[model samples]
Target chain A: MSNKKNALWHLPLIIIGIIALLPVIFMISNSFKTLQESYQSILSVIPNKPTIDNYTTLNHQVNLVRLVWNTFFMATLVTVGKLFTGLLAAYAFRYYQFKHKNLIYLLFVATIFVPFTIVMIPNYLVIAKLNLLNSVIGVALPQLCDATGIMIFLKTMEKIPGSLFDSLKIDNIPNRRIFFNIVLPILKPSIISVGAMFFINSWNEYVWPTLILKDKSSFTLPLALQNYISSEGGTNFPLAMALSSIMIVVPLIIYLIFQRYILNSISNSGLK
Target chain B: MHNNKKILPFLYLMPTGILLTIFMIIPIIYTFYLSFFDWNLIAPTKDFVGMRNYIEVFTDPVNQKVLMNTFFYIILLLVLNFIVPYVISLVVKFFIKRMQGAYKIIFFIPSLFSLVVGAMIFSWLLNPVSGPVAFLFRESGFVLPNWTNSGGLAIIVICLITNWKVFGYNFILLLTGLGSIPKNIVDATTVDRIPKWRMIWNIVLPMNKSIAIYVLILTIVQGLQYVFTPINVITTGGPYYGSSNVLYHTYLNAFVLYKTGNASALAITTFLIFLVLLYLEIKFVEGRSRYE
Candidate 1:
């Protein structure tokens, strides 16, 4: 009798889950459909006539290869920059004490609350003044100030045994060697978790890249997609669906493979 | 050698600090300064406008609609993403014991992609002419409106899409929160043969307060900005700028219109509003957790 009660709730779960998956199912199905089929068979869960016409058209029209490459380049640079800055800053906050250390640390933490919109205009102006507009460096430079990663790494670093640090110190080990040899090894998991998050976030970043990158040739996937969407409409549903799939496929695969680490990183820092 | 130790910490902090100071702190301060000036993006000079830009933001009809849209979006997210998802997760946690991992992965799939991509997919699905939802409505003998073209309804449609993309992340967070609740507490209460609803009311809800507040703040933050994707992708904040929120409005003002002064003013106002909401959250919600 009680088992029936438990099983009854599964109805809601199944219903919501189907609703959640509907968009993906629709997008994929629409991507496969030809233009006429997509319009006529709109309610069809499966494409009546599957074709690769949309992808071919998109590839021909907008240099999909270059957009993907630019996105990868920007995301990679931002990830590396965040990792380096996060590790160094976390090391400083965790290992050392200095005058006004609390103040300086507070300054870093305070940026967490300040929305990026507040600073975007001035940063754009600064980039414009330096003539870095339409460049990848300008797109990625301002985003490298990542306080969340520093916070996450520092919190993880705190859990490391104090005795290990003392033992290394007793041997009169140089700071650089200790960081490279011991600290880096111990921080590997966190690095992966944090780095993957940084990578995912950078991949999805839109506003900053849009602001900084103005040239069509230099555009990231998102900027390129935005441009396409604005210029195109429902007449090009298959093309839009195709581009959406391409944009989604990368991060979806990455998340599925490294789901545990991404979830861990988010829950680890996000809740607290 | 002893003096070098005093500066070692500074050396370690230099890279991140320099980046933060240059890109974050200085620009934030510069935003405040820029808000006071009437400057166009291409202009060589900024006229001292005092509080005129701020006054203009409060007085502007477009900004007023932008503010309403932002609030409406946030309320819808709180309902769609928070209240509804929380209930669903509780049911999933307590009753549906089998295939938990599959459920989490399936639900979280939407969040793996960018909001922009999700927006694109949804715009196609919610398309009035040949989209599936409209097709279903038509099959059912009702004419569905063009959602993106409508004024008030566009915000609702955008929120629905935003929730579809985001609720999974929040669902997992709530599931984690539920998981964090001590099993012993629930087991202890169950010995009295108390009803499940009462047990949930007295035990589960109270224990889950902190995570609830965290999710609330997160929802507010995401809601304020999440509409930007759909507004840009699907509507372009058109149909009389119906779906445009403050963030998108600010973007249009600065980048499209080149009204840097107005954009900066709106940005500052948005930040302050966020601060006030955060403060209230801490004061009310965070304070309640102390009794636990």
Candidate 2:
């Protein structure tokens, strides 16, 4: 059942792979290069004489510790919040035949299609009115309820046979018991994959946070890395790359560890 | 506790419902309400401008051009992110059989990082004066063109950076869909001596249409959204508002200009556009599949 082999096709695919990874390669290599070397050998993947100077310069320019902490706190808050809400709602939908059941589920799904840009301004005013501006809570609050979590959880719940829950129901077991005792254990992998997605999305988030978190202490790594966005961050190339390298390390590790599960979840989700 | 049957389901649904209401539904309604008034945030009064803001959205040259640019962004995104990746997945799935995992991993690595980070790395890599490409050009006795300075090139630069991040992701999704197509179908095509291209165009494609449409719709839905980070990082819709799309333009108008009214009007307008676009997509692209 194998198709014809062609070595020529491998060349183009390999080239595309390199193109895909060029920025990452550039970031890693250039972060260690001296300013002189960076400018001199713009094409090099390995630094001739690597130095820690760029990391130190970036350390002085911004509080890298606070930036990482801020991003981690906000992303974790979002992931936990979304996962908690999503799990409860998904369990209810899967087990119950409540009134407006279809309508309520549709409502959750509808939120997925509402682009953030449309609602951002109003949300800003609301956040400002509540005086949450320049705060990590401001960034985390609006993101807490993601429909993607509910969607993913619901899809996972589909794998748990209805008879499992129904048999428990005939035994006069409370739904809560069934959910905590049975569904929870079965759902551990789905939870991890969904949590990974939620964490990564919130970590990578920029626009909403830009509107909310104004102070340097409140700035996430993305915000911190964005000194180059404005000239105010200065024209230090290697330093910026150093910041990027630091920012990506956590997500890269999480991604590698969860790559198989994440890919399966995405492909499975994509099908339906 | 006997009443738990009616109540527990709702209680479970409550948190999600309330959060979505506060964040999504109410905010959307509030945005529409704000669209009618002219206010600069700190101003004491909001002038009831009626249709004037909508009129401005229609007639303002900058807004008009930005609207056009958003259209171009949609088309370019479809080409680069949707069509290109789907084609790659098709070719890879049916043709090249070796090292598929290597290709998938290579593509998926970039998808794990943020578009904002991608934008920054891209900005550094594509630096016109002193970047690697620029360095290459200098060796050839030619100067590299500044992408940020030109409107079209700036848009292209922004999309390409985004393309670097998303192309692999969408490729993986479509490739998975192509791979999931049953082997027996392809075998039947072989029994009839159907050519690869025709079999693909007829059998494999039709079978994969739903996921294909999902990815297609996603390319428009999330694709334009990806432009926000790159537009912010790289161009800031600069060179005279050249690369700005509706998403970032809304941010600029509301936050930067403090023209909250106009921003709301623009937001509501774009929301409607996307809604209609989605309806049409579901009705047309998704609807057509049922008959087959």
TM-score of each candidate?
0.93, 0.95
CAPRI-style grade of the A/B interface in model 2: medium
| Model 1: DockQ vs. true structure | 0.51
Which ranges of candidate 2 are over 4 A from the true structure? A1-5, B141-143, B280-292
iRMSD (Å) of candidate 1?
Answer: 4.1
| Cα lDDT tens digits for candidate 2, A223-266 | 87776657665666787788889988988888889888887777
Off by over 4 Å in 1: A99-106, A232-234, B277-292
The candidate 2 chain B region of ten consecutive residues with least summed lDDT is B283-292
Per-residue CA lDDT of model 1 for B9-95, tens digit only, reads: 788788887888888878878888989998887888989999999998888888888888777878888999899888987887766
Q: After superposition, how far is residue A237 of candidate 2 from its true place, in Å?
A: 0.5
Cα lDDT of candidate 2 equals 0.83
Docking class of 1: medium
Ten contiguous residues minimizing lDDT sum, candidate 1 chain A:
A263-272
